[model samples]
Target: MAKLISLFFGNAFILAYALDESTNQVEAINLKDISLPITLDSLQTKETIYPIPAMICFDDRIFYGQEVRTHKKFFSPHTFLYMKQYIAKNQHLPRIIGDQEISNFQAAEILMISIIHRIEEIYGAENISMYVFPVPPKGFEIFAQWIEKFCFRIGLVSFKIVDGGVCSLLAYGLGHELGTNFMYINFGPMCLDLYILKVEESSNEPRLRSVLLGGLNKNYGSIDIHKSLRDELIDYNITVRKAAEIVHHLINNQTFEEEINGQQLHFSRTQLHELLNRKGYGQELKNILADLIDLASGIGVTYESVQYVLCAGSSLQVPYYRNILKDFFGYKLLYNKAHNCPAARWSGIPSASGQWQYHQGQLRAPQPDSKGRRL
Candidate 1:
């Protein structure tokens, strides 16, 4: 059988892995610290070139310092947009931005080719057959067929689009008892992903599996704070980069000082907190959490029966969300701070050991790293 590949296309970033069909294990090539140059021509080209560690996008874009600086020098000041909300518009939908009309299909196709270029550098050109990926939630599949067709158009044959069950389970190393119910929230810069799952025993194997009861992704992420802070400093001509740096400093429990346009602004943690309060970040958190609680309630996962809440991904590394998870979920919360899982670790919710949702003709969710691998 051709090897399977695993990919996680979260709002903030893209991660891909090669699956060992024999051992069912995959290792990630270290790519986080490395940065590749961005080009207008590469977006439309697909022929051979030197391999590099980089990625494309689906809808939203996130740029590290490297690309931002490069874009400012070579392209327009608005060459790229980062930490933006996920727009669920259909393919071919007319959208106007910066006097340019670009359809959703064109953007996604560009992202696909760019992603394929990255994958080529990782696993060679033709080593993959099957794929395992995660989608946001209920409405994700509305245009999922386009993704499958895109894969084929790019020469990939088979694919699977599952929910966020496996990533959450392995991320926190939670218990997978049949009755154990857990809530997973992946807080991005511009979006939040919530999943409530119940562990169920697999009919094909002796391992446990998590089944999604309800899932939701909404526009409540760290960018919301950046937006709020921008409003508070509307008088200052602060760029998004400058404002984001200030927010980062505050999140790290340090005073923030930045020169916006010509005026210098400074604030301490206490002041940052007051600003957050003034802009109702706490209230927004309450609203988002309340909605998640309602999702849990809809799925019959009461506070009493719910085993724990797990915050997956890198957002909790920030101070505000770290506090939010603790304040809201309290002692029952676990957070995934490690980008790489340990070598000896295995999934608390095992999927590869069993026949995946294979019987129902459903795509199998991506499993965890059986060995330590970094994105």
Candidate 2:
């Protein structure tokens, strides 16, 4: 029988899977070394007529592994990255990145086309009967309209669009528990999405969560970590690449430094913590906690119903935010780890912060209600 494919449209990358013949069973996944890019070739003619606006590369090719901070000479003309957060967005696209003018629809189409291309390459076009894609929070209606166009353009006959946070729940494998609710907080380059999931009582299947909040921090994320550090280190004239290396060293080791042009730039874990605290990120962490409490309470999230807090993002893996999450969720804090789910891949986050999705704890899926089932 032909296989069913599920496309994971991440904030910075695109990953997909082929389902088993059995009902809703995921047989295979890839977690590492499959981070794909989104690009559009300005050189390409409109008459070329792609299934979508963007492809893995519209009119050119891209090779990863060596880090390229700025697209400049390294990337092709018209190629773009970090556009996933803008798909289905109501606002105009952000000012050109890498001298590329990208529409939200184009970005999403490029990403979708890229994933579909990979799927077709792997399983053959005729083998794919349907697709399962998760939509960003606050983008259900827009995504629906966009996806309708997407399916028509791509000739996808059937598919399902669920909350992206719910994909976190599925990817992390929430256990089945009665009266327990799962809270997932994901930080992407463009925004942070929060999803609160509750299982149905009758079928024990996870359903649409009551707590669905997104775009919590539109202009903040792991990128801010790099930008803030790079800007601060600029006082001593450290290069962006060196600053990125220093940031990486801080995440893995206790202290680190580099000599650039015979100038010593170094910082220990103490300085790292202090820097974050001095910067607005520490306050951003606090703001996140406070908002969680307020939103949880406002949405009727009680200790009785709320069971666990799952942090699923490369940005959240940082000890800085993990410590705060620990304080808020305590033992209930479950994180996503790269080791646990080998079949997974970074959900389109940039390499700067996205690669740090080391390991996070896990939780049990909530028990569904006893009436009509929603999975």
Candidate 3:
């Protein structure tokens, strides 16, 4: 029998886990423990190399997540493929990486290949039975078909694409009994997604369905705040990492003081809040949440009707956003207390893990029918 693996393609990170049938343990693969950065002049480079690091090198040009602190040029650490504006669109816009003009499809394909190479190293190409991935509700079929084609090309035994919202609910259900209706908030660097989910029972098996979805506002996320802070402190030569640290501190209501190039820089919660307010971030968040609430109400899912509000993504850790959610949902908000569980941190993990459990007969959800309906 072959082993099962789950690969979660998150906005900021790519996480993978392997399931051991004998021990019934899910082992997480350290995605950061990737091999040296591969310098490829073209995306078509077919050398069977190890997984590339977070930083990719196009020809002689290199981008770094850690080096952003000292590097003069501002470089985004995230991949273009996961960006919200590109995820749902079929446009093949060209991005300038060094001197190379790489299309969106080429960059995404290269990234996908790197992810597959990493998985292949740990479990071996032939040892894997199936690979499961989860995609967002919007553009579900298109994204699922795109990922399925990639998996098929690798000659995997099988491949499955599950609904991202359902996966999140299942992951939460693994630790707690879920209510009949719940809301899932995925506030990440790329975008903020609000999902209203319903849990139904058929033939003693639980079936998960997305009742309604709203709030795919790409402009509103922690990344925007980070960029704002970086621009605000551009005169002081602040690095991206330092700006992010300051944002984290301010969000947690901690004062941050640092000296750079003989200049002292200080940031307070009040000051940061004022800055964000000036930039209309606070209002933008409120508007997005309000729109989502209105959309839910249209489908007859009122605030009081929601049983639980499950939160995911790193952006929700910010007090500004968390407070907004708390004020809106009150006591219905649920925070993942599994500090040690990777699923708690990444939005895609629970979905992938939930699918893994279903494959192992651990989760009691009925399989989807030909029309992708659970009956």
Candidate 4:
């Protein structure tokens, strides 16, 4: 039997998951480590090339993740291509890649094609029957259309685009429990999306109705937090790359003490918390939750009505955001112990729902409200 593949295109990473026939278990793959080569005639130079640590080369032209960061000449143009705002505003921007100037949309298309090809290589193309993409709630229609077009271009005939919030609920096996309201929050690297959904029995099958959908400002995300931290260290002549490392350490509750440009620097969890507060990261989350609560209240869904708050994405791993969520939801927040990274929990959706076969065609497209927000 052909397998079903589910993909979640995140701002900073692409996650692909499918059921393994041999083991009868779900396998999740992160596509970031896989690099596609850009063939260029200039790469065939006579100069001897030295191998860099943690670098993989293809056709002696393109390099892998770490190498691209190390080599100033090589660039990764599709770093945050999946970001909604980035795609909307800069889709036409030209990205120079090895003497080729590719538009942002073209780059995105190439990246998608590469992802599909990689998936096919892992699980033979002939053995995959369908592709399912779970899109964010706020811009579901636009994201669906864009992703559907790419699917068509890639010649995928059987595919589905479902609400990401609903998928998260199903991933947790909450789809069949009727009359319960669930809040799904995805704290991605680039942005945060929250959705309130009520499970109902529709014609003997579970149905998820959208109660409220909202997101933080597009500029509010873990990456933005990293940028803020980086800016704070700019006076010390800290490079962007080093700042990212420092931020990572701080987020993981590890103290970072280093000397840059002969100046000593130290970062601790307490310092990180203070920085987050000063930058209004916690306040922004609180404000968005308040707004979402107000909207949900208008629809008869109160804070007390929400049973479980399912949190996903790597950002939620950060203590600052996790603490904010804990303060807001308290005991209602749910975490997966089996999978430390909540975002990876999404990969289990396909396997959990048995490939979403029974629930096919039941998910309703979100309708826009007076302010054009999905409700």
Candidate 5:
């Protein structure tokens, strides 16, 4: 069945989901279709409003869109939620790496509410029937009561909030036609979730059966690689930290050019593209690759059942990162596709990092977070 999928980002949330067969895919909906706006009282409401039609899918489980939009000014996308403590020290640099540590309760409730609101906006509340398949982080049971309370309030009285990685497996399973025996890895800013999914095709509709999922806390993300590259430059007194910061910002959007310190330093995306294409930075690129290899080795899945790798997020778009993985793992191993969104399309795939991601303690980062804080 065709469904209206909406992607939402704002506040501290990120959520996405597909509508079921019972729901109609409306290009437009009636104003009288919605219940009173969530924020407004029934007594104060005059009529209903319709929401937009958009497909929703998520890898990180936290709701994006409205929650992120509402809190955008304060939110830095690359930082890990659990590592907020490191934000203050690294805030000076254009790029800062930190893990976002949030209670599962907060993660689930806020995300559900945000998704419900976003769905209401697109299809109108009355017409929208959503099934939230939230990917639970490790130790999800701690948030059980919170999930129960959230379900009761959101009208998802009979919905499911499964593990985010498993949900991703479902999405990836459909996209890749993955059979019962493949594994799925979801690499995000805060953690990496790996799952061994067995699809039970015994029924007419394939179902995710007998899933083994786990979350790893090595926690090397896009910003960590950026910082590592910056440190490599600092060792030579090149001090391209500013440039590195701009590049990090550019990966997400092309607005960083306007924020350059001076016209001499004012580099556009085209110029940055050229910089990556130039021949002088081969060593720097190698250093970045070494870091990623180390990260994979530490994770113990470097040579595991990694048949197809999916790379996403702003980090993987960097030529420095892509070339290294391509050179070492071969062209097919790199998921840098021309037709893809470059960022979103590469989501959940493994790429490279610095010493922090390495296999052994011997290849540790030479210049640690000046403050010795590990990402």
Candidate 6:
């Protein structure tokens, strides 16, 4: 176990360097007068642990940073339009079996692969061996088959599918500094992941124990919410979609310094709360938010037996949501400040005890290290 942990951490460093180098390459190209240093620093700080160069699209706006940058540079506007069409045609259907459908997985994989292909074009496909961990909801077989077909279509010959919540658990286990019980909550599109973690019972030494998995209420992930918002505003409906989109745009674009309705609208942190607090739309918006909160609470109640919750996700970017969690779960509830993509390059070594052996074809017993350590 220790060896495996060490190997992963070592790889994390190498991946970090490669990602940093790619960001520098992008920084070399000057666009929008954005300085290389600022971009470099931003990328370095925001995505130190991500394994490869990828694009992260939240809502309609895209974030192109060092580790997870959008592929806006390579594709034309028409290309994006086609891509959106393909996504909608294939993915926008509701599933009868599980929380998601085949189309849903395909859409996500296509987007992720698009980012991967963009990075490979820059860094050479020979060096890019990627893995994806898509969180699975109840009744995952249907979606799994869909993902398998999508992987084949995308030419991803070698890949692995892990439960998204489990991947987060793997990261959290590896990231533990002290032997204290911890809880992880991953809020994604479709569902939320709740995991209860503690030290194992058998081992005298501290290590991650069995996980108790639960899910919170279901809704479209941040991406879905953002898209809904954009659609509503485009249609001039002051619905949940519009409110969500406005908040999403401001957070990602940061230059929320736009003039709308002949009034200068500075979408600072308080924009969501302020907008929701307004007269007519407030009630409806509050209801939507309340539904999301209820979902979270429902999931929390399933694990209500446990305390110490840590929230992580793109949606957590909203301050109001965090406040809601704190109020509902009490002060003991916390948020994860780690980069959103912790699974790809998570660090921290776990200690595993066993014998090691290296052979030409088969292995024997575990060998001792220089310090006479067996594992």
Full-model lDDT for every candidate: 0.54, 0.50, 0.55, 0.57, 0.37, 0.38
Q: After superposition, how far is residue 168 of candidate 6 from its true place, in Å?
A: 1.9
Candidate 3: C-alpha lDDT? 0.55
Name the TM-score of candidate 4. Answer: 0.62
lDDT of 6: 0.38
Model 5 misses residue 331 by how many Å? 6.7
Model 2 lDDT at residue 148: 54
Q: TM-score of each candidate?
A: 0.60, 0.58, 0.62, 0.62, 0.42, 0.46
What TM-score does model 2 achieve against the real structure?
0.58
What's the residue-level lDDT of 20 in candidate 2?
A: 53
Q: How many residue pairs clash in each candidate?
A: 0, 25, 0, 0, 54, 9
Q: What's the candidate order when arranged by decreasing lDDT? A: 4, 3, 1, 2, 6, 5
Best by lDDT: 4
For model 6, residues 1-375, the per-residue Cα lDDT tens digits are: 011100010100111112222332111111121111101124223211111111112211112121112223224443244334434443322222222222334334544455455545555666544434343333334444555566567766444333333345455443333344446665543334444444333232112233343333333234444444445345343544445657766655643565555656455555445543442333443454455445545655433444456666656666555656676668657566423454343322122211222222243454433444332
Q: Which residue pairs in candidate 6 collide?
A: 2-352, 64-69, 135-164, 189-221, 229-241, 355-366, 356-365, 356-366, 356-367
lDDT of 5 by residue, 1-375 (tens): 433332322113233434443542222122232211212124433222111111112233323232222222223332223123323343211221123222333334544465566666765655533333333334433333345455566545433333333334334333334443334333333233334333332221112222333232233334444444445344333334464566766665654534223333344555555454463444544554455446556555453444544443324555555555567655325343311222122122111131122211123332323333232
Query: What's the C-alpha lDDT at position 41 in model 6?
Result: 24
Q: Which scores greater on lDDT, model 2 or model 5?
A: 2
lDDT of 2 by residue, 302-348 (tens): 64566777665545656676777777678877774521221222222
Q: What would the per-residue lDDT of candidate 3 be over residues 1-375, giving only the tens digit for each residue?
A: 355666655433455766654554566666553333334355644222222322221211113222112222122233332222322342334444445554534545666666677887777877765567756655555666566555546544255566665666656663234346677777655456677776443232224434334433343567678778888888898766777888877765678888887999877877777788899988888887788788888877787877777776666777777777778778888765311123322222222223333333233444565445443
Candidate 2's C-alpha runs over 4 A off are: 1-107, 114-132, 137-145, 148-152, 155-162, 201-218, 239-241, 338-375
